[model samples]
Target: MTGYTCTSCGEHHEELPFAYSAPAPAFWQDAPTDVLEPERCVISGEHYFLRGRLVLPVRDADQDFEWGVWVSVSKDNFFRAEELWDDPKRTDEPPYFGWLATELPGYEPGTLNLKTNLHTRPPGERPLIEVEPTGHPLAVEQRDGITLIRVQAVAELLRHP
Candidate 1:
């Protein structure tokens, strides 16, 4: 595959990054230092968050684009997920309602606090985040799909931003 020139760094990357990730939820990032936890994927206590992937089909490519983001879930759901964390049957669990907790770049209205459903997968896979059906650009892209040009634009934006 051909590489892309990173506008931000003024360097050429060997390949476009098909997935972008947030180390933690925006809330956790902005929280008081005392409330921060060391865990990268799950945050417990007053607020609960779980990292998941929001996948969007690339209309002109064979692979999908993924946003490795976090979503805020209820305490109960958080605990339940923890209990089933290593269970292969965890995939049978019902999807949990959550608020999108990562603010993705390149969207005008912003990608924070959007309604979502976190669907658990098997033991080794991250939960899949399903954005609620809406007129939001991200949601539309999730439902309809994006072209290779759009994916390249996103790669450039995320790489530079």
Candidate 2:
């Protein structure tokens, strides 16, 4: 259930079914056990569930896009980090750290982590970040430093992020 190749109808689909791209990747956290990276949304092939810490779908909040799902680690390390970037360095050009403010240095707070999956249970099953309040303010803030998050619970968690 994972054959891809359709940057918008190139044709080669297989099991596509992913939909979560907005503003939800500050470093989400929920590591207990994961490893299932299976992306496939080049143009609606769908199939996106990367594991490591990806709960994408945040057309608001702070920002969450560019490979995700990795905290406990599942989604098969999100397809083994894209099969190790599918060799050839996948064109290389990542690892940067210049912009993105709101206190994004080491990302502190136990080490880069942000999460959301509200079904109703902000007590502690996870998903209630907002600086840990259990009140789902949809956190991630800094202001002067830049980092600012809180766009209506990630725009309603992007419908189903």
- Note the clash tally of each candidate: 0, 37
Model 2 per-residue lDDT tens digits across residues 43-83: 12222232222233345434442223222222343344446
* Candidate 2 wrong stretches, greater than 4 Å: 1-35, 39-67, 71-105, 112-115, 118-138, 142-161
For model 1, what is the error of residue 61's alpha carbon versus the real structure, in angstroms, after optimal superposition?
0.6
Tell me the alpha-carbon RMSD of every candidate: 2.8, 18.0
Count of clashes in candidate 1: 0
Off-target runs (Cα >4 Å) in candidate 1 are: 5-12, 29-44
Q: What lDDT tens digits, residue by residue, belong to model 1 across residues 1-161?
A: 47776666788888877888887888664534324333233443477888899999998888999999989899899889989989999999999999999999999799999999999999878899999999999999999999877877888886666
Model 2 Cα displacement at 73 (Å)?
A: 9.5
